[model samples]
Target: MGYRRLDKHILKAIFHRWIESQSISRIHREEGFDRKTIRSYIELFEAKGLRPGLQMPDEDLDCVLQELLPKNTRGRNKRELLAPYREELLRLVNPDASSGDPESPAERPAEVVRPKTAYLILVEKYRLEVSYETFKLYAREIGLTAQSKRAPTRLESPPGQETQIDYGTVGTLVDHHNGKARRVYAFAAKLSCSRLPFIQFTYTQNKESWMESNIAMVEFYGGVTECLLIDNLKSGVLKPDLWDPQINRGYAEFAEHYRTFIDTARVGKATDKAKIERLIPQARELFRRLKAIHPTWSLDELNRQALLWCRQEYGRAVHGTTGIAPMSLFEEQEQSLLKSLPPVRFEVPRYKPVKVHPDRFFTFEHKRYAMPENCRGQSFIARESGGILRVFDASYRLIRSYPVTEQRVCWLPGDFPKSREALMQGAYPRYLLSRARTLGPAAERLIDGI
Candidate 1:
């Protein structure tokens, strides 16, 4: 009877009648099956609670029965076989056991319990005869190994209180004008209150790009939040700290201009800005779908499309958490709470520390700017602010300014004397001729000795 195999039709028929409370003899007669066969299948189903008159569905019962019947019953008895090594394995899993005094549990000092790898213990200590796979299976079955799952927690901020920002790569974007593919990055700013998001794309993530994007985001949102949350990007955050964070001077100055505070998330904690982290994946989906629809567009066109998507599609769509459209929520609840934009816009710039040349000049953007005074080889920070280069001393005081131009050399009126000797050493005759021309045509003819 144990070796007999019944067709699916017969097995199901017997299962239905058995569940209906029919006598075994009657089911055997009605289905034309031997009494013993009916009893066997009926017994199997009833044992697993597939009893008659139960409310469970037939499909679920069938699936459970299949799983129970086909499972191989032959295997090593893991618990019985590994019983001798149980104590040793437990000790390895909890090495702090040795640190505790054996005489009293109360005397045990606090210590970190490190989890030892199963392979090391098996190979070095036990030298178990079984394969690694078998050893691992036994360890799991005996509860020496446990897997943990992490649950993500979300945080919320009051309206107009905080904004979280981050940058993500958008893979390679083809430039329609040049027919060349360039890697692009997307910067996202999400308001913690309404989950309203603003996105902009750029070719690079330098200080200038970051600052410009931030300004654009605030302007687009119509106001700035009280505090701006950002990751440890070198463009904005100089050093990440739990209590006191160090922000880049330029970024700090920019924030000050907007009357907003900068808050940096702890290093390596994405949950600190969970709102932005959650929006990134959804933004990527939008980017992919938009790219497919257009295929090739200039950065300006792509940005236009992004703005439309943010306003028309994402903003108007109901959020999963709040059950209200982001744009509606922002306009109704968060907009009024935000701080108004400042009167004057901040001019963003790239900053770098440079040493004054022996000739009292510093090079930036392939052009030289003569220092206003003799810095005498001292270090200074040069701010390449748009069309102008502003030089600041160690104290960040403005000491020199020059227009960034195509000229190979530029000089301040006060700096010509400091560089005069160096220029003469290189081209004394030419320098004299140039200086003569600057004076007048009469001086030039006189210097020519005509």
Candidate 2:
């Protein structure tokens, strides 16, 4: 330490690997440096921007201010851009074409903007002095705006950006081989810029299938998108709300791991991503076209056929709006996205350790879930995703999960159901047999009396 002066490079290298146990004072004293000089050195290093602190400098008294402070992203102004319609309240006064059309202005759809604007007019009809323009300005200042044309504060996309995703049940078809009608889920993604829609058909909308569909969507385009825009699908959105959306923890982790942000469209607002929203009808058309040509055996078969359709016809065909084919745009945009996505190891939650009490076998939603006897007194995480629920040990290894698909009421082969059953039986009362005999006598007397 004495051999090197307190220069930027030397100090930085020392700072980077500084041991947590060694204090600045100890460093100064052991190195034969004055405290004042050491303080100045630290100040100079901080002035040159060395991330003086990883977090807050002092947390005890500053908690309130930290909590109250707004993040930079929150300051966006989305309301100012659409105030004219809110002020007019046209939909209130005019339920019909009596109000000017919103789109064409001359032939405004009375069903939507007309009624909305009419309502505004009717509500403020008493104030005839305030001209429509003036009133609209007033409304804008007050943070009220038309619902339809409220533009985002800043133009978000730089073109060829964002993709919106959703899952829907297209229809039910009879499974000929199984003699059963099964509903199929259509998982779809539409790139906002290109409006190029990608879809995959799957049996269920569970987490694994949900993520698998997303992976296929990415690979189909030969790239990973910077952001995945999705609707309030249960697999992705934990709580569906516009102002405060909560993405599923597993899905959020997946997004973080992939270095992508998973953005959710406002709840109940399909029009939030208009480009993708408009493709639903067209997707149905494509699905119909595929169905006419192929006989599907299963949802997996349907998905494969769908992909082939994209490569052969859908991706090649010219886009109605852009006048360019989807595949062509995808090629141009693909380069902008990540070449190699982060590894795809999703968290497989084995079990949420819900205590199976000393007496009651833990059951969830009418099904019994098994927990280890050693887990009786401890609280545990409940791992639930991918249509399966299970419990896990502290180290996160799998302990036991809900019974496998189609194996309900029976343990898997080589699983000792008897041992688990024995442990389960221990929780029951010892006097149950005597109580059962007394109940039997009471039942017979009641029957005779009747």
**Which candidate should be chosen as best, given lDDT against the real structure?**
1
Residues 156-271, model 1: lDDT tens digits? 78899999999987656777768788887889989998988998878899988999999999999999999999999998888878898888989998999899999999899998
lDDT of each: 0.76, 0.57
Point to the candidate with the largest TM-score.
1
Candidate 2, residue 397: the lDDT equals 69
TM-score of every model versus the real structure:
0.62, 0.47
Off by over 4 Å in 1: 1-151, 403-407, 418-450
Clashes of each: 1, 28
- Model 2, span 1-450: residue lDDT tens: 354444444444334323233567776666665667656655554654544344334343144233323244422233332344443343332324234555576544322322323323333443344445654554455433444654332223544467778877665655766878777667878776655668787668887678767777776765556788888887888798767787775677677766678788877776676666555544554444445334455556776767776665667899766688877876776446544565654454322336565533465544655454455556555666677776666665666666445434423334335444444457233334434456798765554454
